[model samples]
Target: MRIRHPGALWRGAQAAALAAAVCIGGFGTSGEARAEYADVVINNYSDAAGMRPVIFPHWFHRIRFRCKVCHADLGFQFKAGGNEINMVKIIDGQFCGACHNGDIAWSVENCNLCHSGKPGTPTQVHESTIQKLAIQPQAGGQQ
Candidate 1:
């Protein structure tokens, strides 16, 4: 090809580099580009049904909506493992289904998105609220 527009080739290369960076950076080792461990793991009925535990990203949801959205409006209990969440309830527009029913968010059809945790994991809070709020030790043992 004739070297008519040399600058065009540089622009194309830059565009390619940017695209590659975005594609690679958009994903993490796990599925989403967020924390390594989920905020909450719901394994109440997953093990019995031969399915992976449900990894709920509380942090992700908290950033988008207030606590009342799920706690009060959705009737989800404040304590972990308190609410009896299941596929039936979710599909019937209860609990998670209230929002994840293809209207507000993704429906139950996307199983792996929620149940992406390792097998045999128990239902509990992955991260502790106290730990997050606790003051960390300063460098060199200084408070």
Candidate 2:
């Protein structure tokens, strides 16, 4: 049957053409263009301590562990600042403490490792990576 709304068909064609042009140039759908591992900065709850925000680099962690190790086993919320981690919880062997204890990567005593004394570091990384990703195309069709 012939479609009655010709404008709808024209709009759909225009959208498809735009999407094709975008894909041909390298950027996929918005989801594909986004970074696979983004750095999460936890500062909303830590600013009171006068400490810099913790910049958790997902790319670094992804190198050694699977996503399930933290997302599923440790129960970390996927959203940034969603877990509400703090020093007390870390000392109690919760959240980051689950792995950062002396027996593992590094003890909480080494504060400078996570807290770089500069809140802007993580923000800069995130912004730069995002800008780069927007311009550069990924190696494969996948993210």
Candidate 3:
């Protein structure tokens, strides 16, 4: 039997687990692989500031980094719409700025990169059934 390095084995296991997660997460209820759009819409102040809401592509980040990187290390709240993310906080290297400060990722100066959501959209988690359920019916019994 050949001796395998412990670090190499750990890294291989990590890579395999990541691959499995990606493969499983990419499928839908119909068992077919589906594409995911921008996951979160951050419109806390974009509309008031005369800019489009930010479309945060969570899948893009999730595939590259583990959940703890943002949730635990960066102190991001796990629940949607829970974190009070703002430009002032970001520019101060608090949240997204930690990585998007022109080194690890694109700088905040590239407005269109993140602020590419549609006009008049509120901050929310996209593709959620909760949003569909929250829609009230019309006065005439129309959905």
Candidate 4:
């Protein structure tokens, strides 16, 4: 069922595809990248040393805690590594201990979850690997 003005149809499809891509990337233009976790290093740090990487996922906690939960109640230091915390502080009510203490994510029993803060850590690592290994069709079998 070939139609005339094929170019117009192609353009329409291209426009639709682009719109879809933008929607996915922007997540409805919330003005932030919607990922499981975002590696954000707070700055104005000297030599990036003060700039410790922070992992934030809007979806994960948004379902449970409000913005004020971490931003205010937790008093998350906005500056890079500004508020260095340890287990002692957490057990007494500070940083992640504010909620992650089993009441929220999983308490002291799950200490290693957030504190370790491993850069290579992945909440779920399968999807990206599969995409990278995807097979692509070649121009010619004997090329």
Best-performing candidate as measured by lDDT: 3
Candidate 1 versus truth, CA RMSD in Å, comes to 16.8
The residue-level lDDT of candidate 2 at 38 comes to: 71
Write one digit per residue (lDDT tens) for candidate 2, span 63-142: 99999999999999876677777889999999899999998789999998888524422232343424333543332233
Q: Deviation in angstroms for 93 in model 1?
A: 0.4
Clashing pairs in 3: none
List candidate 1 segments past 4 Å from native.
1-38, 129-143
Q: Identify the leading candidate in terms of TM-score.
A: 3
Write the number of the candidate with greater TM-score, choosing between 2 and 4. Answer: 2
Q: What is the lDDT of residue 71 in candidate 3?
A: 88
TM-scores, each model vs. reference: 0.63, 0.59, 0.67, 0.41
Q: Could you tell me the lDDT of residue 141 within candidate 1?
A: 35
Least accurate 10 contiguous residues by lDDT in model 2: 120-129
| lDDT by residue for model 3 (1-143), tens | 23389887787877676566557654234212122554887777787899988888888998999989998999988666578888888899988988999999999999999999777666766655443324322312322
Tens digit per residue, CA lDDT, model 1, 1-143? 33459798887877676667557644223212234343887777887898988888887998889998898998999766789888888888999999898998988899999989777665666545332333322322322
Pick out the ten consecutive residues of candidate 3 with the lowest summed lDDT: 26-35
Each candidate's lDDT (Cα)?
0.71, 0.66, 0.72, 0.48
Across 70-128, the per-residue lDDT of candidate 4 in tens digits comes to 87877885543466655577788788678767776677665334433333222221223
Better of 1 and 3 by TM-score: 3
